[model samples]
Structure formats: structure tokens, C-alpha cells
Target: MNKLGRKLSLSISLAVIVIFSISILLTQYFLPKYYLHKTKERLEQVSNEIKKMDKTTFIHSKETIENKYGITIVYEPINSNVDELNEVVFSQLYKKRITLNKFWITEETLQKLAEGKKVNKIYDQGKLKSSFFASFMQRDDMLVLVGNSIVHFSDTAKIVNEFNLYMLLFSIILIIALVWILSKKITTPLKELKDVSKDISELKFETVHIKTNDEIE
Candidate 1:
């Protein structure tokens, strides 16, 4: 009875752990990817709006666009260095970098921009990260680099993973308790049957204690 109870408990625990662990793994993997894809689409839409704007409108509505989307737009002239941006634009860039300090603009990024392409990028700064859709199009003689910040799905993914871990732990503990109780109930009849068989082997009939509705019990 003791051995059978232990086996049942172990089996139940493994089954519960396997099922919930897979669910947790899937949630951890797919959900963030979905969020990231959605964010990319939104940022690309913002980039399109910027592309259609005239220089005067873009300059005037820059702050509004940034505020509306929770993003910073960095405009760089083809000839000027990144550090040589105008004071107002530099200030906006400085403010945005307060949280995320690092960004990259590779050859591919520049080449794509030269071809009037809007490229999507993922930027990381230590623990902080965000997505951006970048485009370098004709704005007077200058090539304007406009980027929009998208939602940081990685941060949300971390929070979700932590919550699921705690829930998984709690559920496992609960299932173990339930399995133990059920194993005890199931073993009761078997214990009674064993004792009754012992008495009959010695040529004595004894009242059995099993109360199950089955004929064998």
C-alpha cells in the first residue's frame, strides 16, 4: 500500500509538471514574438506618415509626433556627422537617450536609406530595449533619418515569465496534495482485500471492510 501510494503520487506529479511546463514554455516563446510583430507594424505606419510630411510640417510637428508615439526622431544630413544635429533635435535625442543610451546605424541601414527604403531595427541598451522603423528620404538637400519607438515586448515578457513561474509552483503543490489524498482513498479497499484473503487461507471467513459498489470489492 505504501509503495503503491508513492508510485501514484510520483506519476501524478510528473504528469502535472510536464503539462504545465509545456504551457509555460509556449507562452514564454510565442507571446513576445506576437507583440513584437504588432509593434513593428505600428512603427512602420508612423514612418510612412513621416515620409509623406513636407519639411515645414515635419519640423513644426516633430514634437507632436514624438509625444504621440512615445518615440524620438533623429534627423541626420548626409554630409553632417550624427553629433552635428541642430540644437533642438539634439535636445530631443539627448532626452531619449536618457533611458536607452546605445543605438546602431550599420552600412546596410545607410544603404537601405540611400535607396529610399524604410528599414525596421531593434535597439538594445543594457537591460532596456525598443524597436524602431527608420527611413532616410529626401528632405531638401538633407537625408532625414526618422525613427519611431515601438513597445518593448521583452520587458513585458519578463514580467509574464515571473508570474507564470509562481503560478506553476503553486499549482504543483496543490496537485501533490490532491494526488496523496486520492491515493490513500484508492488503497483502502486493496488493504481490506489483502486482510480478508489472509483469513480465508487459514480456513476462517471474516467480514470485509470494503464499501465500494463493485462486485469484487
Candidate 2:
């Protein structure tokens, strides 16, 4: 309804907000995973390289790999120094603060890892998602677990959310301004016609004028 700017501004703003909100929601749901997938691919490559190293080299450089790539490394011994299921041998989270000390690794996963297998898992934390890619390799009496977490995506998701909020505010303001201008342009002739009718009814014979050439005029 172009009766006045208020209704028009409100309707247009709501419409634009619905569309933008859908877009932002979709982005929030999918974009982080897309980024995490890309990150997983890279992590897989690095894990593959680690799988090729001997047991000693892997244990010695576990910290270095964790530091260099900003991942968490955990070594689970199978044939050698067996740790309690809850005991973690080596870990470097790099400030990710992930509560996961034991990953999705199971006996089946360990068996596969012993044969130089790579595993990829996804962790969901409320609206946030993180990725884990690991390689399991057997070294004589030790099982080496090398992995990287795409927890950095949490920061990216936060940035995107903030950006979406700003964009929504901007869109509302812009749509309100445009709708106000358009509403004024559209209702001017009708408003003038109403005034002319009112004057004629009162027998105050004045020249009735409708400027637009449209049928309403």
C-alpha cells in the first residue's frame, strides 16, 4: 500500500530483511563447513606426509608439527607403552581449547591406522563445527596419531556473523530511505485528488488538478 511512507517503509524493510536473513542463515550454516573441508584437504596432505615417517621421527617432531600447523597431536601406544584409555601421551591444542582429548579413534580406527590409514571426522559444537583429519601409522611398538583440527574456523564464523549483523542493519536503513522516497512519489497524486474532492464537496469550487497521466489521476 502506497497510502503513506510508514506502511511502505515497514513492508519493504521487512521483505528485504526476510531475504537477507535467509541468505545470511544459509551462509552461516554452510560456509564454515566449506572452509573446514578445504582445511581438511590440506590437513590430509600433511598427515599423509607424517604417515611416511618412522616412529622415532614422528614422536620427536610431533610437537613441531603441532606448532607449525596449529593442530593437536596425540600419540596412543598399541604395542609398547600402553596408556590408560583416558591417558593422553602427547597433545598440543595450540589454544583451540577443544575438550576432546580422545578423538573418534576406536579399535577399528586403530587397526586401520596401523595399516597407514587416514581418518576424517567432524565435531559439532552448537552452531559451530570443527574438522579433524588424522593419520594412524604403526611404528614397531608404538602407534602414532597425527592430526589437525580446523578449530580456527570458529574465528572465521564469528567474523562472518558480525559482518551479517552489520549488513542487516545497513540493509534496513537503505531500504527504509528508498521506500520513503518511492512512497512519496506514488501517493502524491492520490493525496492531491482527495484534497480536490473534499473542496468540491464543500462547494468551494476550485480547479481540480491531478498531475500524473495514469488512470488513477
Candidate 3:
């Protein structure tokens, strides 16, 4: 096979590969982005319902929680010790928790909770899994906080998440570059082949001496 033929074949194969790689990359990029946007929209709709009541409300609600909020639960209680107290505590806490949009609390926020004050809250981007509630009320000589881990955020957790996102984006760019270069190399030969074929057909040569297809499979 002549040098020209080999080059043409290489270009054809490269074109094929580049096209395939581009298709794959586009699929990878768009599907996740589309679904993520959809999820964000859906979550945002529900996210606004979270409510954090004042400590006094948290306390007073406990007395009437069962009558006000009790319903059949999917999970049964393992132990039935002190049923009324448990129901009251669970209902008061769960009602507040169910309305929370994001899982996070600051020391200032906790302080307010302890003092029976109200504060606006935002979700902690660092922690993906916060959906807990807490109540702090002064009793005699002590300040008590009752909260579940579901609504807290940590600084280190946010940093780690940001790092992972950067790594994912870097990996995506690397893959795209690899695909692009491979596409260019593979297409170069195919372009040559197209030119050569055109010349042959246009001329209608009785005997062509070109050995160009040597590299073409």
C-alpha cells in the first residue's frame, strides 16, 4: 500500500472513533445535567415548607401532639415503653422537622432555639443528609437541646464535596480532549480518500495505478 492509502484508511478509522466518542460524551454530559435540573426544580418546590417553631411552641405542642398529629406509621415501635410521652415528643419534633427545607443549624440558631426565639434558616450545602429537628427549653437550672442529626452541616463536609465536583469536571474535560484529538487524526486520511476517489471517477481512467487503498480495511 502506498503512503496515501495508509493515511486515508487511518483517517477513516479515526473519524469513526471520534464520532463515536463525541456521541458518548454528549450523552454523559446532558443526561446528568438535565436530570439534575429537574431534581432541583422538584426539590425546590418542596423545600419551602420547612418550619422551625419557637421553643415555647415546641414545648406547648407536646401536650396536644397526639390528638393533633398522630397517624398510622409505616414502622411500628419496637418497644412500647411510656407510649404517651414518646408520642408527644416524637410528634412535636417530627412536625417541625418535616417542614425544614435544609439540614443545618448554627450556634447562633441553636442559641435562639434555646431562648425560644425564631430565626430564618438556610440549608447547609456541605451536608447532603440533614433532616433532623431539635428543641431547647430551659427547665429549672438547665438548658436542654433535643435534636436529631438530620439537620446539621459541617465545614469539612462542604469542602470535600466541592473537591469531588472539581475532580469530576476535570475528568470530563480530559475525556473530551482525548476524543477530539483522536477524531482529528482519524478524519485526516478519510479526507484524502475522498479527494482521490473524486479524481478517479471524474477522469474515468481505463487503468488506475494508484495503490492507495493499502491501509484501508
Candidate 4:
């Protein structure tokens, strides 16, 4: 009911809101950036190791893009008489629902891959699966298709989303606790003022316990 009490409550609410907003913005920026850098480092490591394999191994063909996520090496050339592995692997990767970028190493794509040139990529978010199919031939007899899954990206996004959700929840709780503690402190001062004012008006100021601290007495 007191003016001091009203002012204190309003100030506390505003400060809490501002602090919470800053927390959300900072976490949103930093957490995702860190996660992306870490993921890129990992994928780069895998891809680089793959490049090494290309140099060392005697090729019946340039190695087909092996499905790296959950699928086992279904048929490495040494074990299988059927080089029909390309067709089978292609069908299975499509079914598993993990496709991000596809480079059909055509004469054009192979040229690009060989030259280490960046291909013009038109990413179709609507049909992400379209990114999965790139056809190639390592040798005349071997058809190599190098493709990736949307799962790698989707998993990254999911993890980042979960992380952001945790940040938001933590910020909310921290702001609430701060506001509660400050609100009580703010009320204590105003309530002191109120009681003092009331006692003065009622002419009981002489016996009033105006000071809260025993140490200050």
C-alpha cells in the first residue's frame, strides 16, 4: 500500500527482466558457436582420414563414400564378389534418412573434386533427401557414390536446441530466485518506513522499535 513498497517492487521486476534478457542473448550466441566449431572439427577429422585412405590403398576403384554413421561396412570390395554394393548401399542410405550434401562426381564433379574446387551448391532445404545422391565411377567397372546423411546435421541441431533449452530454464530460475530475495529485502525497508510513519501519526513514536539491527543499537 505504501509508495516506497510500490517503487521497490517495480524496480526489482524491471531489473530481473533485463538481466534475464541479457542471459538468453549471451547463451544463444556462445553455446551454438562453440558446438558448431566442435562438430566441424570432428567431421573434418573423419573426412581427412578418408582422404588418407584414398592415397594408400591400391584401388580396384576410388573408394565409394562409406555410410559413416550407423551402417556397418556392408561390403568392402575385398570380401564381396558383388560390386553391386553401390546399388545396395545407395538404397539403404536413402532408407535410413540421412542426406545432407550430394556430389555426383560426373566428369564435371570429378574435375571439381580432383581440382579441390568448391562446387556451386544449391541447398534445397525442402527436399533435403535430394542432397543425398551423387553418382560417380572410380574405374570403368566400379560406380562410386559419395553421399552424407541429414542425420549428422539434424543431430547437431537437436543437441543445440536441448542445450539452449537448458540455458533458458536456468536463466528463468536464477532470475526468479534473485527477484524473490531482493523483493523481500526491498519490502523489509519499506515496511520499516511504513511502521515508523504509522507510529508517529498515532503518537506512539516514543516506544517504537525503529531500528531492525541489534548490532547498530
Candidate 5:
């Protein structure tokens, strides 16, 4: 490759690297947050749907709702004594037994529930990373809890980076070929001009017929 081809290839390779680096960083930082936000929104929607249903309808459809949404639904009485709240009533669909304390239901969260506000919690400690949505059912006088496992995007980021690596390799090869073609086209005209200058210096007056259509012509 000549000087022009080398320069063009380097510039394009640098631009491609910069672009892919920014894309990878953005995916690493923002993609998981966006997924979490969407998951929270979905949980809030489910909570609202439960709030709209009557007690009998909600109780009868508990299993169906749990299966449909892939979430665990639990309810606890709105007791003033938090310590007395040892166990929360779990839906029949829930296989594992869980205590009220496991849900991270604190005094502040209870207060928020009493004031007609939904509380959201993220459990990131155990092997199962999950998000919980808690809301108060005024009609039934019950605190409704909905829990769903959170999907981590680390694996997704890894897959994307791997795909980008393959694409970068392919792009490098394509850019090299493209740079070679372009440099040949540009230098062909310059080479012809150089030959014409040499001939003129030797007093060989031949008609220079360079038809490059650009200023190089």
C-alpha cells in the first residue's frame, strides 16, 4: 500500500474503534438500567390491575395471575404491630415459604402503603436477584406484594461485545480493500501527471490526455 492508502486506512480504523468503544460503554452502563426501569413499570402495571379487582375476583384468580405474569403474589393483613406480622399469606402458586421480613417490609414501607402509595424494592443479595412491588388494597384491608426475578444484562453485554468483535474484524478487512481501490484511483492520475512532467523536461512534446474529470485532470 502507498502513503495515501495507509493514511486513509488508519483514519477509518481509528473512527471505527472509537465508535465501537462508545457503543460498548453505553450498552454496559445504560442498557441494564433501561431494562430495570421497564421491569419496574411492568410490575407497577400489575399492581394497578390487582388494585382494580374486587377481593373475591382477586382471590379466585390468584393462581391464574401468578402463572400469567410469572410473579409471586402475597397478601398480609394491615396490622399495627409489625412484630406480630410473622408470616405473609402466599399465593398457592408460590412453592417456597417466605416470611414478611424477607420482603424487607419496614415501618417506612408500611407507612407508604397506608398512605395509598406503592413501594418498590430490589433484592440483589441472593442467587435470585428480584424486584418486589408492594401496594395496599383498601377494600380488602390487605397489603398486596408482587415479586418477580430481575434479569441481569451482563450476559447480554457479553454477547453484544462478541458480536461487535466479529463485526470489527470484518469491517477492517472491508476498509482495507476499499482504501486500496480508492488510493489506486487517486494515485493513477498523479502518476500520469508525473510521467507527463518527465517527458516535457526531456522536450518530448506529446499531447497529455489525462481525463480524470476532477482538478487532477
Candidate 6:
């Protein structure tokens, strides 16, 4: 490749690298947060729908809700002790025995729920990486708990970065080919001019035919 082709290729490759680097950095910084926000919003919507259901409907539609939203639905008496709430909710949701500390529910969270506020949190402990969203709403004497576990997207981000890497490689190859062709087109006329000057210097005046249809010709 000529000097112009090499320069063009280098400049274009550097630009592509910079752009891809910024894109990957931005994705790493914001994608998880954005995903979490949307997941929480969806869970909140589901919780609202659950809040509107009567006890009979809620119970009857439990399977439908779980299957539709990929969530777990459980309810308990509003008068249940707040301290034991976490255990009850966790057991009902996961159907397993886990320490109370593993659950994200706390006194404050329970208080907010009692006040008819939605609760959302991230649970990342003991091989569990999930976004937990819940709301406690009264349906007669029962407090309906609508909750969901959303898996984190670290693997998805990894796949995206891998795809960007492949795109960068493909773009570099394309840039190199385009730059080579462009440089050759631009320099060909200049090479002919150089030869014409050399012939005139040697007193070899001849009819020179250059028909590039540009100033170089």
C-alpha cells in the first residue's frame, strides 16, 4: 500500500476503535441500570394488577399470574408479625429453607409496604443475583404480596461486547480495502504528471493524452 492508503487506513481504524470503546464503556455503565429500571417498572405494573384482584380471583389466577409475568405470588394475613414476614414470604416464593438474612425484607421495607408503597431491591448473595420487586396491598383481611426475581444481564453484556469486537474486525478489513482503492485512484494521475514533467525536462516534447476529467489531468 502507498503512504496515502496507509494513512487513511490508520486514521479510519483509530476512529472505529475510539467509537467502539466509548460504546462498550457506555453499555457497561448504563445498560444494567436501565435494564433494572425497566424490570422494576414491569414488576410494579404486575403488582398493581394484583392489587386490584379480590382474594378469590387472586388465588384462582395465581398460576396464570405466575406464568404470565414469570413471578411468584403469595399472601398472608395483614396481622402477621412483621419480624417473621421475611421468612414467610421467602419460603412461599422459593419453597426452600433459607436464613432470614438472605431475604431483603426488613422492618422498614415492611412498614413501607404496610403504607401501600411498592418495594424494590436487588438480591445478590449466595449464588442468587436477581432484582426483587414487591408490593403489599390489602385485600380484605389478607395482604397480597406480588414479587418477582429478574436475572442479571452480565452474560448479555458479554455477548454484546463480543459482537462489537467482531464488528470492529470486519470494519477494519473493509476500511483497508476502501482506502487502498481510493488512494490508488487519487495517486495514479499524480504519477502520470510526474512522468510528463520528466519527459519535458529531457526535451522529449510529445502529445500527452490525459483524460481524467479533473484538474489533475
What's the count of clashing pairs in each model shown?
0, 0, 11, 4, 0, 0
Cα lDDT of candidate 4 equals 0.45
Give every collision pair in model 2.
Answer: none
Supply the TM-score for candidate 3: 0.27
Task: List where candidate 4 sits over 4 angstroms from the true fold.
Answer: 1-41, 53-103, 116-147, 151-185, 189-217
Candidate ranking (lDDT, best to worst) = 6, 5, 1, 2, 4, 3
lDDT of each: 0.66, 0.65, 0.43, 0.45, 0.73, 0.74
Task: Write candidate 3's Cα lDDT for 90-185 as tens digits.
Answer: 554456544333433345544554575533322333435443333333333233333333323334345544655565556555555565665565
At residue 148, candidate 6 shows an lDDT of 58
- Which run of 10 residues does model 2 get worst, by summed lDDT? 85-94
The alpha-carbon RMSD values of the candidates against the true structure, listed in the order shown, are 5.9, 7.5, 13.5, 8.3, 4.6, 4.3
Worst 10 residues of 1 by lDDT: 81-90
Q: For candidate 4, lDDT tens digit of each residue in 1-217? A: 3455456556765665676566556555665556445544544444444445543352422233343432212112311333355346545455555443442223454454445542332233444423322222232222333333222344455566577667656666665666666566556756677887898999876543445353322
Query: Model 3, residue 176: displacement in angstroms?
Result: 3.2
Q: Which scores better on TM-score, 4 or 5? A: 5
Which segments of model 5 are wrong by more than 4 Å?
Answer: 45-108, 129-140, 200-217
For residues 1-217, what per-residue lDDT tens digits would candidate 2 score against the true structure? Answer: 3557888778777887888778777677877668667667767766776767887788788778878877666655574323343244333233346555445446665567567655555544334455455555555656555555555455666687788889889988887788778777778877787898898999877876666677876
Off by over 4 Å in 2: 1-19, 52-60, 80-105, 121-135, 139-141, 148-166, 175-217
The deviation in Å at residue 178 for candidate 5 is 2.0
- Badly placed stretches (over 4 Å) of model 3 are 1-147, 154-157, 201-217
lDDT of 6 by residue, 1-217 (tens): 9999999999999999999998887777788888777777777888778778777888899889878987666787755576676566767767722222355557776577667666666565535554455555556666576665565667778889989999999999999999999999888888887888899999987766777788877
Q: Which candidate is the best by TM-score?
A: 6
lDDT of 5 by residue, 1-217 (tens): 9999999999999999889888888888998888777777777777888878889898888778878877677666778776555343433214444322244457887777678777777755344433333333334578777766665677778899889889888998999999999999999889988998899999987877777788987
Residue 204 deviation, candidate 1, in Å? 26
Once model 3 is optimally superposed onto the true structure by TM-score, how far is the C-alpha of residue 79 displaced, in angstroms?
22
Misplaced by over 4 Å in model 1 are: 1-19, 80-92, 98-101, 104-108, 126-142, 146-159, 172-217
User: Quick one: best lDDT, which candidate?
Assistant: 6
TM-score of 6: 0.71
